[model samples]
Target: MVTRPASPSSRARLASARGTPRPDRQMAILLAAEKLFAQHGYHGVSIRQIAEEAQVPLALVGYYYGPKSELFHAIFEHWQGTIQERLALLQQVLAGPPTEAFLRQVVEAFVRPVLVQRASTEGEYYAQLVGRELARQTPETHRVLTEFFDPLAHSFIDAIHAARPGHDRARAAWAYQFALGALLHHITDHRAPTLSRGRNQVCAPEAAALLVDFITAGIAAVMPLPSSLSPSPTASPSPRRRAPSPSTTSRRQA
Candidate 1:
């Protein structure tokens, strides 16, 4: 979401509209919006239901965050740090000389931050919200992805091309899209544990490693790495984005 935080005066107006200022009010509204929007599609949630979920006046939801679309945009805006961190990790991997682990590191640079988010209490709802959005194809879904995620998606596809010269960039992009579907399904679908008879719990910490395995293998199918590369110690994979705590003030506004 390109939406940034409101100014202090804007916050004052938001609080005044509610007839009381509570510092947690805006964040509460965002959390509620994230949950409801994830469980229900964008069209399915109403501002009044969000207010009820957050235990705030219905008017406060509008004053604090505006309409449903704005609230949806705010969720991605609130997680803008995630996009930045992913970019930073990608650049770090590219900065190093290419190595045996080059493609795998590139995939991790893209995937780990999402998994880190899914594992956190604060980010779980948001992760599911993102999952819902990614699974759809509408003007709003296209807008959100194009505005907030397309740049990142391009960066990763370009990196994939870099790792395997002569691979068509368009194919690389499709590979990225496929990997994203698998990643999101891991978080949103609970059938893994059932299918595996409890051996493949998606919420378990090791599930993250499993996701990387599947994604890296899938990417290799699209952009096959050379058979003779050697691993380099300099190319360590993960540069994780630390999840925010409950009191962690958002870097942007709702």
Candidate 2:
């Protein structure tokens, strides 16, 4: 048979073609890692297991992520992007006039984006992962949580303060924390039997109104001095003299 030799250019082209699968393989590893991490806490997972789940070469996980901690951090960084996009939408809503009427809008802005995603499979998994991480409270996980949450909480405090200027800084911070606790419960409590018992409900539009009112009232109650400072409530009680005439009339009748 007459044989043909491959040219250097052809060999280079083949080599380049062979390299194209690398990125796809890396992405597969990440997706597998995310799923595994979601299902099993970080400590429960291993790189070898992840590589097997991804069906990629065992070396690729270390090559892409360096270590399991790095892989977890990468996943967290991806989640941060999603959080930033949602916060940006919230910021736009907050830029408008801040009023009691806007309180529900504010709550919805903070909450709806997260709750809306619960319908999707990936979102459900991600939410579960976040809950698990919070429960775990590993140092690495705590760092990620604080890094992701603290700024958002501070911004929310600013928004609350802007909406109710009479509120003091401490009270505003407390209100923000309360609002967050409520939101966190809503997100993490997937099996709240209280809902079936009619004691609590999640994602109800009325619950939005209830939250706005509850938070507003709680803040207002805690910061009563704000209202006390207003002229309407602070007006001095009209002074009254003793009814001397009535005493004299009673003495004369006796």
Candidate 3:
């Protein structure tokens, strides 16, 4: 056979013809998978479905992530990392005197990151995913709450307790719950009908301040004084037994 050599362009074209996709395509697949998984529960979605939504090869899902479970975990990890970065930045800003200022900082730290994400293109979708997972109370979500969320809540509780010395632990816990409930509801609901009807409004930064103020006042109002610190009022002496009333005794003797 007559020998033939491949031209540089031909070789380059051959390489280009290979099935490998660009990095952005892989990211699109992941993003699509996340949206689907978030919309439908993990068990409700399939790799093929994600591939179709992402417009990538069906096998690409498994190629990028070994299994559906891995892919699910990856999506959560990615969102959590983004949130944590914002949290870390806020924490740095909060590292100072423990005053109302610090409390405001803490509140902003907790709320701003998630709120900012809520305003992004992916934020609403991802937040819905988080809400669904939270509502379902899945094992993975529970683990994330325990590992990431609970610690942050406890830290805030401790800070509040310290700032208000006489605050009872139970009351502090309740106040923390109140603050968290407000934030959670806002995120899950996004002040929809309430704001839509002009009954309520939610400004991200201002809401943070309001939550801190509401929680701090609630804690201050309900928290009981420490037992050791509470002073007992002096009681008035009871009427003297009258020593059997000397005049009455004398009359009885007569």
Query: lDDT of each model, Cα atoms only?
Result: 0.73, 0.61, 0.59
Best by TM-score: 1
lDDT of 1 by residue, 1-254 (tens): 22345667766766656665575878888889889988887889889899999998777777656677888888888888888888889888877763556778988988888778777887777877887765577766766776778777777777777666556767776887888778777777768789989787767788777788899988888776443332346655333222111112222111
RMSD of 1: 8.1
Clashes of each: 1, 0, 0
lDDT of 2 by residue, 1-254 (tens): 11123466754654553455456776677778888988998889999999999997676576567779878777767667666765776677665543344444555566666666654556666676776776565777766656666566565555556555555656767776677666666666756557578655545545555655666566556544345443354475322111111011111100
Ten residues in sequence with the least summed lDDT for candidate 2:
245-254
- Candidate 1: which stretches are off by over 4 Å? 1-19, 226-254
Q: Higher-TM-score candidate among 1 and 3?
A: 1
| Ranking of models by lDDT | 1, 2, 3
Q: What is the alpha-carbon lDDT of model 2 when measured against the actual structure?
A: 0.61
Cα RMSD for predicted model 3: 19.4
Error of 3 at 142 (Å): 3.1
* lDDT: worst 10-residue window of model 1: 245-254
- Whichever of 2 and 3 has more lDDT, that candidate is 2
